[model samples]
Structures are given as structure tokens and as C-alpha cells.
Target: MRRPATTRAITRATTLAAAALVAAGSLSACAVGGSDDGPLVVVSTNILGDVVENLVGDEVEVMTLMKPDADPHSFEISAQEAARLRSADLVVSNGLGLEEGLQQHLDAAADEDVPTFVAGDVIEVLEYAEGDAAGTPDSHFWTDPARVLDVVDALAPVLADLDGVDAGVVEEQAADYRAEVEQVDAEMTESFASIPAERRALVTNHHVFGYLADRFDFEVVGAVIPGGTTLAAPSASDLADLVGAVEETGVPTIFAESSSPDRLVQALASEADVHVDVVELFTESLTAPDGGAPDYLTMMRVNTERITDGLSA
Candidate 1:
């Protein structure tokens, strides 16, 4: 006997639905793709996640919403990770408008009464120039090791309050980390001082190194993209202007952020019609444990050496 049309249609619909359910389940199974166990600390970016991991030191679970080397400005969390943020014992974020896509989720987590800590809240913030960023605040605080020391200082006390955490351990780890940060700072300061005054100029893919510039006394000639975030693209005239700045400022290298595309910075260097080198630096994100910049201290040290070499060349 032949099946009725209605029965056949229903069978097809059911099969489609089951397939959809399986696919959805698979996606949800690895939602946000991070570790989860013990008291949870959900951080917005991998950089901060590394810091939190070091500070907490297995006392509690640490889950970073952003993937390794992901751009903090535009990286977003999954719905499941957003839910985790809401339920996490503490949600730590860079704040200062850095996580543009994740800001709403951070706010949602805070609204749900989850304990939240904004690293920008404790550290001093820098602003863009009058015509550079339309008056946006600079959000790349981790560029400055001194400021990262400030982050460690702020998080140590807050993390100590989490249940099952030992305050003594937190303080000790924080103190050790601060010393490391200071050591890197001193090393970078001395390394950067070796560059001649005329060679201390910088031109990057974007306005990423403001904190580094301010801390180390390097002049930010300009960026290929005239803003703090990489989401903004450059107009022909913007590239033209940066090319002129590169030539006029005598920038030896146009530093491209490791996390951002180098096409535009390359274009600027190519347009400069000079022998300007385009050097890659781990500016915003941390690499995997096996990568050169696996942690904050290593990242800073690597970038310091790269910048020092690139500029002094």
C-alpha cells in the first residue's frame, strides 16, 4: 500500500527537524569553546584570561570567552557563553568600550547581579586625539606593563573574595606578577632608551600603542587607520595621508598588529615608496602556550624586543 501524501510530508518534516536538532546540539556542545569547572571566572578577552589564570592559579576555573589571538574589539561570545557569564561567580572584562560585541553581554551579566570586574575601571585611561577617534577612549590598557601591574593589583583583592579561594595565595601570586611586570617595564624602558631621539617615531596599523607610546616616550606618528579599533577601514586619502606621514616622520617600520590584517599597513608602506619595513607585533592578544607570546609577560617582552629592533633598524 502507498503512503498518503500527508504521511509522507510529515515524515520528511520530522527527519528535517531531527537533523536540525542534532546539528544544534553539536554546536551547543562546544559553545564558546573553553574550560568549565569549579568556581568559574569568565573573562572577556584571552589577555585578561591569562592574567586571571595566573592570579587565581587553579584555585578556581577560568573560562575565556575570546579565542586565542582573537581581536578583543570585535570578538563576541555565544549565547551559551553569555549565559555562563550571567551565572559565573565573577565576570572580568577589559571594559572601556574595548569589547564592542561583548559589551551587551557584560552588561547583561552585571544586570543579573553576577559579580563583575572591569580592568579599565581601575587603570588610568587614555583618549584619542581631537580628530583621530571621534572622542573615543583608548581601551588597549594591556599595552602598558605598568598598567597591567595595576590590573594585577585590582584583581588580586577582588579574586580573593571568591569562595574557596585562599587570600594568601592570591596576594603572593599578584606580588610575583607585579614584580615581573615591573621587570619587563624596566627592561623595555632601558631598551627603548637606546634608540636615537630621531628614531623614536612609530606608525602602526592602528592606534594600538598609545599606552605604550605614552609610557615609553615614543611619538605616535599616526596609524594607517585613523582610529583605536581595527574595524575601521582606511580611505584612499587616509592611506595617502599615512604614507606622507611615514615619509615625513622617517618611520623605519610600519608596525602591524599581529591580530589585525596587514594589507592596509602594507599598502601604506608600499605607498610610502620608501624602504619602510612592516613588522608584526603581538599587540592585543596572547598566543597559545607554545606560541612566543603565551602570557602577558612574554607578550610584553617579545613586543618590546621587536619594537626596539624594528625602530632602531
Candidate 2:
């Protein structure tokens, strides 16, 4: 069964719905901040923010720069946040060109010698299989739980090195989270095993599923957008080409990422000759506390179930 929207999600939707009229007045009030005390760990994206929080618990203050439902490709940070990044005890970011807008700030933080951890560094990276970004390293490694476990394993030692954190506590917490991640991995493997080989094809808003496809032995049929980033738009010919691919593959469902608008995917489904269904997946970011995908593990499970159901039907 599909989950209902959380209270925080409803509140965020309402805020955005009214932003055009009230943004100017609400600018100062909406600024994000965390406690000035304790060891501060600044994270570029909310997805990583959740992971860091789970691993460290209340031992450190995690300041997640990206808001829930925000696109990491184009989400910009405030000057205050950038300053925080430079001064943070440790800064965590999803690297390999994922944070396009925040790259300069990340560079600035590193320039100032903030200990930084890039999640992409520890995993076996996959390249974009096709499109304009073909052959470029794909930074969406978290799609594969095995790769995510690599990140978890590498991160535990780093968190243990943090000055205020108890090394034993960090290791224990990471072990617990590691077990949870492994359980999700086993569940995903079992669930995806049920999908027929012919039906294991993915089409998304962009080329975000390359790692998932590589991990699960699925074919990346194509994408509505031509590249790895959602900031890029599709041309008419691009859409036409994708329509042909969809018709050829006869994939029942095409996915739209939650962090991006589904209009283009919906339009592509409408344009397809086959009866295509557009399903939303939490590809880039996590949702609020009451959301279906509030954390990394839940996000993967929700997506695994959705993909299984979407393709099985």
C-alpha cells in the first residue's frame, strides 16, 4: 500500500505553494541553523545528513545544507552556511560532480583545511552508460546497497577519529546501521530476483539509475533527459528518440525522481506508443520525518517495493 504524505511534507508543500507571494518577507525567517555548541559536522545533502545522523547519533551536530525535496544538482547554499562549512569539524559531501552548485563552497571548505569526506571516493564508481554524459563517473552510488555499505564501512573510521566522539560508540553505532543496510540489501536482492530478466529495464527522469541497473542486472533503456544531471533539458528529438526506445523495450513503467519535477516523464509516458506508467522514486533526496522515505534504509526499501510492484505488474 502507498503511504500518505507526512505532516512535514504537507507543511513544506504549503510553504512552496505560497513562496511566490511570501518569499521576500520570509527570507530571513527561513534561514537554517544548528546549535553553536558541540562538534559540528556539515553535510552538503540531506540524504548524507540522515546517514551521518544515524551513525553519530547525538554526539555531533549535523547541519544539512540541502533542504528536503531539494535538487542537489542546483541547490545553492547561503553565505552563512558556506561559512559554517569552512569552520565545521568535519564536512561530508556527495562528490564526483553531484553537487554542481555547492562545489565552490566545498572547495572553499577544503581550502580552509576542513576534514572532508566524499562518499563517492570509497565506492566502485559506474559511468553513464549512454546519453551526453556517457563515460562520466556516475555519483548515484547509494542506489546499490552494497556500495552504500562500502561508504558505511569507510565512514565509521572517520567518525571514530572525530575529537569528541567515542571511537567504540561510533564503531558500535556503525555496526548497527551496517546490519540494517545489509538486511535491506538482502531484501532488495530477493525482491529483484523475482523480476523476469526481460522486465528488468529502467527508464528515469535522467541517467540516475545506472548504478542500480549495474548492481541488479537491469538494462538502462533510456531517459527523458539526455544526461546525468536534471539541470539539463531535453530537445524534441531527444524525446522522440526516447519514445522509440520505450516502444521497442515495451517497459511498463518509467520512473520520475522525487527531487525533480515529473512533468517531463509524464509527458514522455503520454507520448509513448505503449501504455507506459510513470512512477516517482526518491532518487536524490530524502523527505521529512513523517515521509515514506525519511532515512536511507527506508528510502531503499520503499523504492525496492515500488520497483518490484511496478515491474511485476
Candidate 3:
């Protein structure tokens, strides 16, 4: 049975409250400049924040700066958030230039000798063309469930050390989540494999699917924005070239992120005189609880279904 949104929200709130209780003394210890019993981990993006919360469960106090649907690239942190970052026992960031606004806070925390984990650093980064300004290691690795399992593997030990938590329990939970991620990965692989190889190329607003393409053997021919970050605007010529590429490649689908407007891709599709499907994917942020891509697993599954169905059609 599908859980109601109110019930899910209440469940999430209750889980968070439990985690808060477990980490309260640890947070207090950190506030008093003493040894912390548990870790206060702050995630820069809500997507990573969700994964962190899942891995840690109710064992650690996990706070996220970016809310649901918040744009991670341009998100601004308030003074209270800055204080939270400063006092956090550990800080987890999506990294790879995803948190442009929170970089300073992360650096500040690093300066204070707090343990910081960049989830991107754990995965093999996919780089873009040399002259392309949007070429940074794509920060959306969690789009691939296997890569998220890798993150859970990396996060297990860090989460286990938090105060008021049983290390064994945390490790056990992490293992269980990792198994689930593996199952999701296998399912996605099978689902994506249903699409013929020739139809597997992807064109999106930005280079958000590097990990997915790499994992699933899909060719990312080009992006409308031609960069790693979505903040860059595509030049008229860039659009022309991308449209031309789309025409030549005959890829009927053009993906746009939930946080980005589809106007540019829509215009390009019209100009190219080809039918383009501008499917929305949860790239930088997860959808609201009631929306389609509320969690990591569902987000990837929805994206996979869209890509496979669109391209296959």
C-alpha cells in the first residue's frame, strides 16, 4: 500500500527526532568544546542529506542546509546554518563543485579541524572537455544506485563513531542499505539493458548523468548547457550545435533537471524540427515527499524509466 504524504512526513520527523535525541549529548559535548559522544553531521545538499540520514538512520543527528527542490549550486546559507556547520562534528558535502555557496563554510569547518567527507571524492570522477567551463567532475554520482552503495560503504565507519549509537548496529544498517542499493542497481541495469544499444545516447540540459552513462554504457553525446554546473548559460552557437547534434543523432529525448527551466531545450527542439521529449529528472535535489522522486532509489528508477521509455520510443 502507498503511504500517505502526511504519514511519511510524520515518520521522517519522528526518525529525525530520534536521531536528535541520540546525538543530543554529543552535540552538547561539541558545543562545550569537549569530546563528543556522537557526531553532528551536516550535509550540504538535501540529496546527500537524505542518503546520509538513511545510512545513519536514527543513530546520528543529520541536518541538511538545502531543502527539498532547493538548487544546490546557488543555495545560500544563513548565519544560523553557518553556526551549525561550525559546530558539526562531521560535515558531508556532495562536493565536486556542487556546493558553490557552501564551499566557504566547508573550508571554515576544515580549518577548525572538523572531519569533512566529500562523497564525490570517493567515486571516480568523470571530467568534461578541457576548454569547456562547465567541465568539472560531475557531482551527481548518486544518480547511479551502485555509486550510492559505494557512498554508503564509505559512510559506514564515520556514522558508527557518533555518540550514543551502537557501532555494530550502524554497521549492520549500512550493510542492509548497501544490499538494497545493490538490488536497485541490478534492477536498473536490467531495465536499461532493455533499450537497444543504438538508442542509448542521452542529451540533457547539463552533464548531470555522467555516472549513469558510464555505468549503463549510454553515450552522453552533448548537453544543452555544455558544462558540469547548470549555472552556465548556453551560447546561441552552442545551442545551434547541440540542436544540430540532436538532429543528426536522432535522439528524440532531451532531459531537463527539475531545478532548471525547459525553455532552452524546448526552443532548441523546435528549431531543430525534431520531436524532443523534455523529461524532468531529479538531478540536484530530491522531489517533495508527495512527488515522484522523493528518495534516492525512486529518483533513479523514475529517471531510468523515463530515459529508457523515451529513447526506446
Among residues 3 or more apart in sequence or in different chains, the pairs in candidate 1 whose N, CA or C atoms overlap within 3 Å are none
Best prediction by lDDT: 2
Q: For each candidate, give its TM-score against the true structure.
A: 0.86, 0.87, 0.86
Candidate 2 accuracy as TM-score: 0.87
Evaluated against the true structure, the overall lDDT of model 3 is: 0.82
- Residues 93-145 of candidate 3: C-alpha lDDT, one tens digit per residue: 88888888778989999999878888988887777652275455777788778
Total clashing pairs for each candidate? 0, 0, 5
Over 1-313, each residue of candidate 2 has an lDDT whose tens digit, in order, gives: 6456797788888889788658765654454322554678999998889889889988788899999888999999888888889999999999989999999999999999999999999989988867788899998888988998898899989988888778888888999999999999999999999998889998899988888888889898888898989989999999999999999989999999999999999999999999989999998999987877888889999999999988988
Ten contiguous residues with the weakest lDDT in model 1:
29-38
TM-score-best of 1 and 2: 2
- Model number with the top TM-score: 2
Residue-wise C-alpha lDDT for candidate 1, range 70-170, written one tens digit per residue: 88888877788888889999999998888988888888888889999999999999998734585788998888888998888888999998887888988
Better of 2 and 3 by TM-score: 2
Off-target runs (Cα >4 Å) in candidate 2 are 1-37
Off by over 4 Å in 3: 1-38
